[model samples]
Target: MAIIPFNKPYLTGKETAYICQAVESGKISGNGGFTKKCQAFFEKRYGFKKCLLTTSCTDALEMAAILCNIQPGDEVIVPSYTFVSSALAFIRQGAKIVFADSYFDNPNIDADKIEQLITSKTKVIVPVHYAGVACNMDKIMEIAGKYGLFVVEDAAQAIDSYYKERPLGSIGHFAAFSFHETKNVISGEGGMLVINDEQFINRAEIIWEKGTNRAEFFRGEVNKYGWVDTGSSFLPSEIVAAFLYAQLENLDEIQKKRKEIWNYYKCLISNTIENYQLPTIPYFATNNAHMFYLICPDLSFRTKLLQKFKDNEVLAVFHYLSLHKSSYYKDKHDGRELPNADKYSDCLVRLPLYYELSDKQVEYIVSLLNY
Candidate 1:
């Protein structure tokens, strides 16, 4: 028996060639030719007001936390079912995290419950698009407008995905995207921050360049660059940007193949599986086929399901443990029971659905589930 791994990053065959060209061009530093090209590609394609390439999605979230002006004792609402970066970014800014629950039917933040979480100290809502599915952005935006709160979309899994006709990253005031090897697109480890509000664009660039007007100075808008605010080194080298650009150039082909894999998995599983809930892509969201996941009936069932994979020489995986219940945050939580989030934490299982996963493998996995 051969093992089918959970994930395998697909390369476009141009990554090293672009990296070599970038190396030969004599600028391997950040914000050079390749960086600009990647940024321009996103802005033009997504209609983002401004785009900045960052070292990772975590860095992009950190930049969003800064742009939101989070302060000590401020509050940020984040879904408990999300990765820690969604909450940790605001927490680093000295903001208190108010963990929200996921919807009973899906892993998105329960939008209807968002208002109850808002308070005088509330400053931002960090919505993570779990598995690349959109949260209810319309409701979220309405709540934000009513309370004068900022929205920083954690679009790490949502590259090339959409909310209605609008791109996922463009709907929020600020959005962060991941280009981790595990994602549909691969640059080893890279990300982007999108600013939809015009007012924050200048400050965003300053923040991206380590709190200096260096970007302006270099563009001839200023005579000298000086440190004027707080920031850190968030830029990735041109080598990373070059690799990312190569991936970006093949976005359509990559997406098409990924979607094909995802569809095949869904078709096979629907015919064979009877006890698990498949991933849900809402009517308002476009699936990017970032990953395919299942919700077992209970934790015991999920444990058995994972063991079955091991017995069959396959590797499926569980997703996030609810941040509210994690060792670090359990005591800090406000004590409201987030049943749905905890349920997902205990029972969600993600199967292999990468660009390279084959139809035969999908059939085998589904057959195993049926057995």
Candidate 2:
């Protein structure tokens, strides 16, 4: 039996061609031709004020932390059900992570619960677009505006997803996107920091260029590059940009295939809701088909279903373990209890979702669910 893996990175052949051109053109370093091409592509496509490629989404997040002036003792509101990068990025910058609760249906931070946790020390609100589903950005933004807080979107899974026809990354003051192999786009390990606010563009470039006026020097705006502020080596090699440009060029095709698989799963199991609850898509959000997950009745049922998949040579898996429940953050958790986030952390099971998934494989996977 052929084992169906949970995720597979898809690539278009344009990489080698671009990489060859990059090498032949004699500039295969950071912020070279391929890198600039990707930056321009993302900025034009997403309406980002500025976009900088980084070594990883984690790096982009750290840059955002610095740009936002996250300081020691400053509280940043984030969901406890998201990837550790969402909280740890700020935590590394000496900000205290104020863990929030998840929404009832998705892993996104519940916007309704944000205000009650606010304090004079609160500085930023990090919202992860879990499973490529948009959170209630309007509610989140309104709260941020009212409280004078910065909104940083942890849009690692939301490259092609949208919120109210506006692109996900453009809605927040700063947004971090991943190009890791597991994401819709693949460069093995890469990320982008998007600046939506105009005021942050110059500083963002400086942060990406290791605190030097290198970007200005390259543009002839500065006679020579000079160190100006504290920064790190966040830029990726041209090889990563080469691979990523290929994926970005084929973004529509990849998204088309993934959506087909996602819809197929939804159609196959839609009728099964009488026995098991299926994944719910909010009417307000347009998803990018990043992941297709189902909600079992309980944690035990989800675990059993996963075992059944393992027995059948299908690599089904569960998503995140709520961050608040982790040993590192247990003491840091807010006193308020979050039943929905806890329930989702226990019951959600993500099935295999990738661009190359065939219709026959989809049918076989769904058929096993009926057993």
Candidate 3:
């Protein structure tokens, strides 16, 4: 039996050529030619206000934290069903996390409950776009406006996704995207911080340049670069940016292939499966094919399905454990219970859906699951 992975990165034939060009250009450092190309590509492609590539989504989120002025005792709202970096970035800036409950049908934070969690100290609302499906951004923005809070979208899985015709990353005050190997696009490990608010662009450039006004200096806007503020080395090497440029160039093709496989799985198993639910497409959200998942009957059933996949030389996997229930956060959770988050975290199973996966393979996997 062939081993089908939970996810696999695809290379679009241009990676080696671009890397060689970068090497020959004698600018293999950060913010080189290739990096500029990638940044420009994103700015034009997504209509982002200002896009700056970072070493990883973790770094981009950290940049958002800085831009939002996250401080000690400040509170930030986040969903418990997302990756730790989604919340930990702000937490590292000394903000207290207020874990939000997930929507009944999706892992995104419930927008209706957001207003109830806002307090005087609530500084930001971080919404994670789980599995490429957008959260209710309109409601979130309304709530933020009412409370004077910042919105930082964790759009790691939502590169090509849209919410009511607005691009996912462009809707938030600040947005972070991932180009990790497992994502629809691959840069081995890379990310981008998108600033929609004009006020954040200057400071964000300084933050990306290790607390220096070096970017302005490079562009001849300043005579000399000096230490401006607190920052870190968040930029990636030119090599990674070169690879990412190749991926960006092929974004449409990559998304198309992934969607094909996702649709195949849905069509093959929708009629045969029982006690399991296929991923839903809300009327307001457009797909980017970031993930294809199923809701199992329970935690035990999810585990059994994963083991069954393993036995068949496939690698379907489960998602996060609710952050609120984790030992690290449970004691400090202030007695809040995220019931919906807890339920999805325990029962969600993600099947393999990658750009290079074949339709026949998807059918075979779905057939096995039905069996």
Q: Return the TM-score for each candidate structure.
A: 0.99, 0.97, 0.98
Per-residue lDDT over 1-371 for candidate 1, one digit per residue giving the tens place of the 0 to 100 score: 47999998888899999999999999999999999999999999989999999999999999999999999999999999999999998889999999999999899999999999999999999899999999999999999999999999999999999998899999889999999999988789999999999999999999999999999999999999999988889999999999999999999999999999899888887876789999988899999999899999999999998999999989999999999988988998999999999999998999987877888888888887864
Q: Which residue pairs clash within candidate 1? A: none
Assess candidate 3 and give its TM-score to the true structure: 0.98
The segments of candidate 3 whose C-alpha lies over 4 angstroms from its true place after superposition are: none
- Give per-model CA RMSD: 0.8, 1.2, 0.9
1-371 per-residue lDDT for model 3 (tens digits): 58998878788999999999999999898999999999898788779999999999999999999999998999999999999999889989999889999977888889999999988999999999999898999999999998899999999999889999999999999999999988999899999999999999999999999999999999999999999998999999999999999988898888888888878777777877888877877788988888889998888988888888899988998889999888887887878878889888889988898877887788778866764
Q: How big is the positional error of residue 210 in model 3, measured in Å on the Cα after superposition?
A: 0.8
Query: What is the per-residue lDDT of model 2 for residues 166-186, given as tens digits with 9 covering 90 to 100?
Result: 899989899999998999998
lDDT of each: 0.93, 0.89, 0.90
Note the residue pairs that clash in candidate 3: none
